[model samples]
Target: MEFWRYYRVIRRRRWLILLGTLAAVLMVVYWNYTTPTMYIGKTTLMEPKGQTQDGVPLFQSQMMGTMLDPQLQLSNLGNIATSQKVLSNAAQSLAELGLKMDPEDILAATSVHPERDTNILAIEVTLPDEQEAKVAADAIATEFKKTYDELNNQALKDSRNFIEGQINSTRNAMVKAQDALRRYKEQNGVVEINQQLADSVQNLYLAQTNANQAQINHEAAASRAMKAATELAKLPESQIAGTSISRNPIWERLSESLTDLETKKAAMLNGVPGQPRRGPNHPEVVALQAQINDVKDQLSKTKSDYIASTQQAKNPVWQTAYGNWFQAKVEDVATGAQAAAAENVIKKMKSEMSQLPAKEAELAKLQVDLKAATDTYSLMKSKLDEAKIRENQGSSEVALRTIDPAHVTEAHNNGLLKLALALVLAPLMGIGVAFLLHYTDNTVKTAADAEKLLGLPVLTAIPGSKAHSLPRQHCPEIMDVAYQMLTSNLWVATQNQADNGIVMVSAEPDAGRSVNASNLAVALAREGAKVILVDADLRKPTQHLIFGVDNKVGLTNVLSGGATLEDALALTRVQGLLLIPAGPVPDNPVKLLRSPEMKEFVDQVKEFADFVVFDTPAGVTFPDPVLVASQVGSAVVVHSAGRVPRGSEAELRQRLESIGVRLIGAVLNKVRREDSSSFFHYHRSYEGVVMPQLTSGKKAIKSGPRDQA
Candidate 1:
């Protein structure tokens, strides 16, 4: 999970990645060495520069004289170069030259690449023979040029024929339109009708002017009559009495009498200057007042009659005003009638002018047809002349000039590219496979593995020591530090337990359980503690060989009660350390290890020794290790780093836990110290000199308290 842990895996499996990469690259190299080489021929052709060939443009112009884009032209040329017709022609020419190559073969071996943004085509051909490659390339180029010229000539000829036919058809149409125009002019006797149409329009406008003047005059007359009539009708009856009321004789006579009587009444009421003026009913005053009342009554009646007669059109002044208004209305009606006649005349003239436009439209249509036909005929004739000139040019107008003739060269087998691909992919694949193996591998290799696999702390990591191979102890100080750490951790783990027995065992055989137990015993003994390492693996005991002790009498003899502890216990080369080797192979190591005598012996040894480490058989394969582990009551599982599978370690821890063995911790034994420094390798304090040494193969230690004791 950490970067360093992944780096460790890569470092450990670096050989595999290297081997895989080398193998892949070597395979590619071998293939390249064995593969056959091919010869390639190349030729280049430049595009036509739109130059004229004998008065004809190389790029033929259309009837409309429009030239194609250069890019489009180049694309068409490329297509023709690779076209089946050109390729087949090339094949046929080659066959004629005694080279019977199939068209498909030639096509397959040939490639046409048109340079982008440039009007150059590069043709390449690869074949077995160099000369054949050159010949094939040159032949294909020649055939392409020839086929393109032929196709271009055919297109030009088709264009000429089509243009000629169009020109003839247009000429005929132009002649017909001309004849129709002449006939129309003769039949209609119309040289120019615009002037006649203009004159008719002028006449209609003049009529409209006269009609407008008449309407103005009639409106003025009507307005004057209306004003006169309204003024006469609005006048008060008193103001019109002489003029308007005289028309009614009865009202005029009544008005005169009422005025005379009112004048006499006013004089009578005056009473001659100071008289009591008719205080009482004077006869003269009474008479005049009565006359005035009667006259007033008569005047009111006559005025009512006059007003009613005026409303009924009987008033003389109202009649005169009404007659004048009627006369004005008649004049207005007559003038409007004349204006309507003029409008009708104008409509007739407009109708005739609208017909003139039809004739003008006909004439314009004939003129347009004649002009279009003439233009088309002239254009087609010019295009036809160009086409004839091009045809006479002998297809040179569309011919291709070889910029560079075909040349032969050796074809690379693409080994360099293959090598490059291999070089790039091989390492990647190797790394992928390496990481795959690392992920799939379930072995316990580091302290993290111990914690992950068994949930146990790694008490110490004893790296692979040279002491195992040599008779003399020549291991680095890391080994000493590892054993010291192991013994110290064991003491700390078992400080609460009264029993001093600890069984060092592994999930499988040869997992450094014996070596770790012996080394830890020596380390403890060096601390001045009485340490005993008992080889309990009677099936395959290794402590006897490691400490150079006699296996003729050891744990087995003591457990069987055939010999006393003093006789079975052998002093090792390490001072203060005792070894009890597994005596001669037994018939039933499990029964022997499980005997009560074995427990008593372990208790007796614990009584004498400060610490006892029992080297038991592998717990996974043999039950003796489990029996010894149960009797010992304490366990230190020694797992060889990068060797023991975690699955087995987990299974062993589960079994030991289930059986009530006090598992102190696990020691990752035989850890290979990576050259890349780590915490374990940093303590190289013993690089200077040797302090003391342990003897191997039955030699008792000559130093330390062993000799003195």
Candidate 2:
């Protein structure tokens, strides 16, 4: 996998792995510990022989690619420790921990492993509880070492015993060679051989035999003597071989050393006899010369006798005996001396061997006595390794021990951010979804909503009938704002055309046209205009509630010849506004409104009123708004900003103008307050009545001090 893919796995499934791993770890910990128990234990160990040098620790060079599979050693340690025998021993030891488990069970619970290659073995045993587990571990560790040490000691002792056996034979052979050489040399004769002189040959021969025999017997002797003799002159065996005292170029000097010394002394004595600067005996040179001359005379006279005679025949026995003495005694003595030189090495070996057999034997016995111990130790070590492995796994594969660890909390992960996002996205999505459904929605949300779909204009939006419950007492500021808004819109609709001013207050059936018309009349009357509120909606006459007047004798009766126009016309409670309430429910209200009487009634009211505001049922329900709008000079199309169907605005306009009316503009109403928090409505009032802004903000001016008076 790519690193990022691994990252994603860690990112997305982090929770799964994290939660799972945390649960696993917690379980392990809980299993290992309970009751918040505190536990402590210490373990120590000494290095095995050869594993340490002078008490300094050393480890074998270990690396990844080496032939030594170190991981295998670790893995094996884990495996072997978990073996049945080790488990049993571990169980037995854990008895002190108050554990009642079988040896096998305890071993299964315990773990064993090496502390690197430090020859340090670690064992961990768990009990039913925390203190118990610690105690079990300590017991297992102690017994485990005992078991291992015994086995090692026993093995070492066995090896030492074997080495000791090999050493004896080598010693015996060494001694025999010494005795043989000694006996051969005692039988052989010693002769003084003078190598320098043409002298007694027999004497030289006997001396040769003695020298040859000594050479034969003296290999070890020579080696030992060579080691001891510093100047090389006093050596006995070498002397018998007839070597001169020193090398010299003079022919006379190259002869035997004794002869040379004697010759030189005689010459010195004879030449310088009585010619010394002092007395003849007083010169040190003369005295030394005389002494040497006398000794040489004796050596020459003594050796001259045999040097000639013995030179004629060489003795076979002496030759053969000399050869034997050289080979056996001499070589053997050399061998023994070399062997002796290895004393330190031998002693070291013995010392090591001395420790081995007992250790080896002990190891064997340990195998028998603590066989279960070995097994238990191995098991505990392995299990401990597994536990360590598990602990390692808990660190990364599980995100439990986080840099920011999670704790029990009332808040959720990313909760605040989530809530904020929902607060924003939910509404946005809701609106979008609402709009999406709105396209398929048949009900009206606004006049535009209806018009866009149905191609119609909406007439009057009846401000909902709950009067601002307490009027100014309820909220003057807000109601004033609404009043000003409606009036301003209507005033704009009537711009430059007040004659035949018809305000079509309409909706679909039950859309509250009466309520709309009455308030609009009140609004206009309060504006100082002569406004006539007419209940022209024959299908459902409701202007009576708005006027709070009797509907027993009104438009229906007047038109049907039961009353006159004067009797039907009534002054409403609102100033400058007149009401023409529909007297009663008419069966053919449409026909009555369409009659010439209705036209005459309109003409009459138009003469007296500055604006004729018609309250009509929705165009779809009744045709009064359409009829009046068609006759008027200008029409104010009031559309329920909301509530009206999506296409109602366009449809209402179409209906009004279908009979040839010119629509000045439309008044948008039932505008939402909370839902449309984005739009701000500002207001000011003249007493209880609301006065509309005459123009845009750019055109508005504050009244001067003089005008304020």
Candidate 3:
């Protein structure tokens, strides 16, 4: 199948495409008309600024600290703007307008979208009605600003209070420190260090202890020397030099007894105990005392001499020469004096500290406590002042401005958008439906579809002839176009195959394939080909009228081997053309067509003629054409333009090919010219192929006129 042949079938199926397109387009229009409408509105918002307009001096200084951003003292201002609390107030504010609407209903339709690269936020409101949508947008935006202003004044008060506390605390702390230092000065006298008194007291104790210890040490030394001398004197010459006390007990006892006596005696005053006369004594005591005195003086002088000797003895020197006794005496005296001094100092300090509590660390702690309390009071005071200012600010009225005033629109919907969408989609859907039909029709889809289904090559596409042609007697200009295109297609087809050959034209009954055949024969004859038109559709053939030939003895007489060649071959009125009309409708057309003699007849005709054209029945429904297609050089399919059967072309081509017939081309007869402009895309190449109007060509061809048998 060739491209041109595929194009012919599409041209025939044009009605299906057109009908499908119109149905889809109408449905789209209907749907668009029935859809409901929606309306939208918007209000632009200004960035929130913590600014006040009231003329009041008391709170103005405090407000200086209230900045909306940077510190983010309040970034949730937008949240407050759309808050339910704000919305409720805004709705109340609108009561004077007398539109009864729920706060939730108004809020539901409201939305906020902040702009990038800018501080402005736009509030959009959507509703069933445009006017309502617009009014609600304005209401919500205005109320949001009021609520934010009130919140700002309160925030300023909080800042002022926070700062005031610090100033108060600093002042109070300064006062406390001053008071503490003054009290300490007033309570304690001018203090001085008594270095001379301390040094004299220390010397007095040292001197007393040293004098007493000196007396004790001198006596110990005297006794020890006297005892050693006595021991030496008592020692018999042998053990006398270095004998220890234990080596001679009697001598040692005697020596210790004598030393104790001397030491006790020294502990007394020199003449105070001469009779031990410091205290009262009994008569016996008096006598013993007298004796003791006498002995003491004697012992003293003796001890002195002996002491000198013992002191010269060979024993090494001792520690402090009675160091323990002297040390005990000195320590006892020093301890008493130091105890007295420490008691006096501790007593003085207690008295001084007790007298001036305010001048001590306790005073500083009191000052610090007072400062902290005062600071707290000042801060709270500032907060209270700010709260007062805020309370006043809230009571003040807020100002409002409008960018776009609310107004009713003429149309309540997006009419332009709706109309635009309908226009674009309707036609698109129409074209979509046309393709659906093209795909779903199931006739040969393309030239290739036909080729594959039919196993035959379709050669040409013949534009259809008009049905009104015969009644009008003009042969329809379309008939002439069909004839010319058919001839040109064949001319092009056989130009390479042979100079002249057999050609067949066929279609369903009343499809005018026979008319197509007769006209095509005349057309080829005019071109100077020795053409023979065979009405091979013997079962129900109609070529006799189209060719004005007698059907009494035609193809049947010739093929039955009953009539002479001249009798069966009738000369058509067309010069260089001949017709073997279907003489009578046969009972078994397929059997007659398949006969051996009929095959012989086609071979003989081919030997005699330059070209042979057969007018066979529609190849799709009948087998006659297939049996005859084997006999002709080439058979052409005649399709009614814009009216070819759903599967007929595919089936027709297959019938011819199954019997090994070579299809020459197709004739699209009875074409509709109304939508020719649209179909011109397919018909463009065949433009000059149609004979130039054919007025002169009709006069030159003396073809036989139509005669009903």
**Best-performing candidate as measured by TM-score:** 1
**lDDT tens digits by residue: candidate 3, 1-709:** 3555445445555666566556655665666577555456776655534445222223223123222332232234446657898778767766757656677876776667656545556667777676666777677777876665565464344434533554465457557756754575567643332464334334433433333333333333333344444544544332224332223444454456566655444333221211221222445445545656666555544422112221134321122223322443344445444545544543453444344433343443333334444444454465556546655664443322345554433335545565666657655565555556655554332333434433445443444444432312455444555465567767778888852545454535666677666766777776676677788877677777765668898888777766755566777666677777887776777777888988777776775566777777766567777777776656777555434234455556655677777776554444444323323553555544545332223322133232111
- Reference-based lDDT, residue 58, model 3: 30
> What would the per-residue lDDT of candidate 2 be over residues 274-360, giving only the tens digit for each residue?
221232464765766676666656554442322212223333334433443343344456545544544444344334434434433
For every model shown, what is its TM-score relative to the native structure? 0.57, 0.37, 0.44
Candidate order by TM-score, decreasing, is 1, 3, 2
Decide which is better by lDDT, 2 or 3: 3
RMSD of each: 43.4, 43.9, 48.7
Candidate 2 similarity to native, TM-score: 0.37
Q: Which pairs, if any, clash in model 1?
A: 548-698
TM-score head-to-head 2 vs 3, winner? 3
Candidate 2 minimal-lDDT segment of 10 residues: 53-62
Each model's C-alpha lDDT? Answer: 0.71, 0.48, 0.54
Model 2 residue runs over 4 Å out of place are 1-466, 469-475, 485-495, 507-512, 674-709
lDDT of 3 at 650: 56
Each candidate's clash count: 1, 79, 11
> Which 10-residue span in candidate 3 carries the lowest summed lDDT?
270-279
